[model samples]
Target: MLYRFKSQATADLVMLVADAQGALRLIGKDLTPEGVISPDQLPWAIDILQHAWREDNDLGLREDTYATEQLAEQDDENPDVRLSQRLVPLVNMLELANKAQVAVVWSAS
Candidate 1:
């Protein structure tokens, strides 16, 4: 399954359900069928996500829950994709939505 995030301020964003859920979980959101992040909430959401990403990158504390040993090994042999990397697009979308005073919404499919 996939989640499609829409924002009046930015292009539509699509992500695998796992990736979207991982990031949303950081901000205390569940991967429901649909949801919204209001403009007022964007700053806090962005902060939480960026902080978690930084901590994961700098301290390597959080396990990449989506990755298995086999995938980890494959990543080592190829270009790596980290939680931090996966969160960037979502963060960018939120930032833009905040600036434009619009809401960010997502629906599971």
Candidate 2:
């Protein structure tokens, strides 16, 4: 899976990928992308991404629950303030997409 972030806050873009085993692997040439999302921010991002994926793909509840739990654990050790800060952009992204009524595309083939 792959994710891309584009925003006015920074000139560079952010991209992340996950391998077949669900291990996240950072990609793209621009490491210091404008948005500067840290590894700590990834779980929240993944939570959103996975929710969209499951909804769009009509995934089973069991699968969704398992994934959600796993992703939630990623932020357990993070400071509350840092987690809140990280989630702000993610929530904004979701709101922006929702306002645009964007259709989340899924590939479950």
C-alpha lDDT of all candidate models, in order: 0.86, 0.39
lDDT of 2 by residue, 33-100 (tens): 12333434534545655554445345445555776777687856532222223334444554454445
Candidate that scores best on TM-score: 1
* Candidate 1 runs further than 4 Å off: 60-76
Candidate 1, residues 4-109, lDDT tens digits: the string is: 9999999999999889999888988866899999888899999999998897676443344444555766765553577788899999999999989999999999
Clashing pairs in 1: none
What global local distance difference test value does model 2 have?
0.39
The RMSD of every model to the true structure, in order and in angstroms, is 5.2, 13.1
Clashes of 1: 0
Error of 2 at 84 (Å): 0.4
Quote the lDDT for 49 in model 2. 52
